[model samples]
Target: MDLATLMSKGLVGPLTAPPAREASFPYGLDKHGLHEIAEAAYGDRAAATGFLLAAAPRPPRRTILLWVTQASTARDMGRVPEAALREATGGKARRLSLVTRHATDALWAVEEAVVSGVVSHVIAEVDSADFTATRRLTLASERHGVPVTLLLPHICEGATAATTRWRVGPQPSAPNRYDPRAPGHARWRVHLERCRAAPALVGQAFDLEWNDETLSLNMVPGMVTGSPAPGEAPPHPGFPNRRTG
Candidate 1:
């Protein structure tokens, strides 16, 4: 066989590009994937967790979701209360919460759950995960067709192999319709630090509102608010003399 003939037969200088990843999970993730949610310097980490809980791919009606968090994190941030969880997910997900003493153990449990295939989703709240550990989790998640998320603190830096990395911060609540002093809907300022699938949206910022009634995350171009002037009223010290006839 001649060199030219071998070349014609496609001995190949570089391999062909792999097929485009199929859409298996919501938000442009393949069947199996790794997503990371990290807090900012003064951002709301619980909001980050709620964002994940509210926005992560919904597996099915009856599938189980795993939540693994470090003991220290549970102490600091406190667990996502049942009311919040219910409000976020519309009481759809059946979550099994587990607390681990160390981050490593929590990570291990995340990997095992991803590989198990029984659980549909896994969310682990650990202090940090190095690139290597995250890479392993990524591989396992991709293989088993399970989606896993790592919720790390603000200090986590450097590179990671996760599908996407988001920095979540709590924004001021939208103005209340009935009461000016009361909070309206939950709002978040989400920064898409990294996105393996949609690199175009990477580094983009999104102002999101979590509508618990609909259990949906809506993207608002700008803040939706109203001035409190229309609802303002001077307090009366003597009697209820505002509007009664």
Candidate 2:
């Protein structure tokens, strides 16, 4: 049996409790198959766009990002703007062919990519969705082994096919460990609204700290459990110097 199971059974001696698991989005923008970012904070589309542009991954070809955007969006939240998407992917986005359509069209495209076996990833930004669409996409994504990420507006409702749903928001910058007063690049609070991959981590909140130098997020560990008490005393030769009456 594993160490954890043995400890729980009282078979092992003293043991320390496991660390609390914290939810973090360290896989960059692509970790969750998200190709579009929402401007939930600052109300500026540029901020979200800029963040994504600076975080897109680079690797071998064979991945497809289906950007679906609304034609009526004022801030261009429907799909990652071509310019911004291009910048984020370091011009690789230029090869992406956008299928401009309504929310329903976008959802259908995701399913198509999943079954086609040509696209490795699919991203859809929609206004409103229902349970049926999400259900179909979920099955398609699983069967085809392709990752599909949905970017919804503030009023997103209904069901979803995503493995995890997150509410990402900007957080106050963490103080620099080296300079104490200097401000860090940026920080975010990612609330795991849903997680099918790891149910045990559901409802867990993570305080993510971003490092600009390494362009990565290092999770801040919290609530470390103390060591358990020993069952028996250790052997010793010492004796009391004084005795009570």
Candidate 3:
């Protein structure tokens, strides 16, 4: 059958374009639609989660966020702590979480949350989603004016109807100025695999740092070097080197 015929019969997802408007990186992502953030590799889900939390648009006052997670993803990555959410969102986030037994259930929950008109935003972590599922989410988010973000595993691939797709990986954090032995603010290497808002920027990559003090995410020049900043001592050998939060 033809593509249009399949869509009409609910055998395939219908593809749609985002609203026409000038859009820029970062902020433009806040537009009403579905976006996907996937891990660059195994164990990079933490980095992807961190990026989503730090970069997601702040909801208007009084509206809470809806977070949906599939069982497998939740068991592997664990839930975000209340303190971490407070720190990441600068204490402005009021969140409701839901755990589903399967990816289909998680996707259903996301769509329901979007159409419910109760949540300011929706975030979901699922094991996988095909193009049809993503397209449904995109349509719901755009129609309801509620933004949705999907956190996917590294194995996620192939076509998707999301407005944008980002692959995030952890990077060595900048040196700690207060104490060189300690880890500083978290950093991530974000690669834009696909972008409907800015097609030309599809393959661009960015090195970003999350500043907890300023509650902002900023792009840095390049990867941080091993040398410490002026007046700071080198990292101590006794302390184990690990990824920063």
Please tell me which predicted candidate would have the highest TM-score against the true structure: 3
Better of 1 and 2 by TM-score: 1
Error of 2 at 63 (Å): 4.0
Model 2 ranges off by over 4 Å: 1-58, 74-101, 175-183, 221-245
- Model 2: lowest-lDDT 10 consecutive positions: 223-232
- Backbone clashes for every candidate come to 0, 2, 0
Instruction: Write candidate 2's Cα lDDT for 7-26 as tens digits.
Output: 68644434132212224342
TM-score ranking from best candidate downward: 3, 1, 2
lDDT, candidate 1, equals: 0.76
Model 1 lDDT per residue over 1-245, tens place: 88787567643223233324532223433245788888876447878886787677765476788999899999998888777766665567788999999999999999888877789888899988999888888777766678888888988888998888888888776666778768777788888888787777777888887777787777765635322244456685888657867
TM-score of 2: 0.60
Clashing pairs in 2: 53-88, 69-78
Task: For candidate 2, give the lDDT.
Answer: 0.53
TM-score per candidate, chains pooled? 0.80, 0.60, 0.84
Q: Please report, in order, the local distance difference test score of every candidate based on alpha carbons.
A: 0.76, 0.53, 0.84
- Collision pairs in model 1: none
Q: After superposition, how far is residue 190 of candidate 1 from its true place, in Å?
A: 0.5
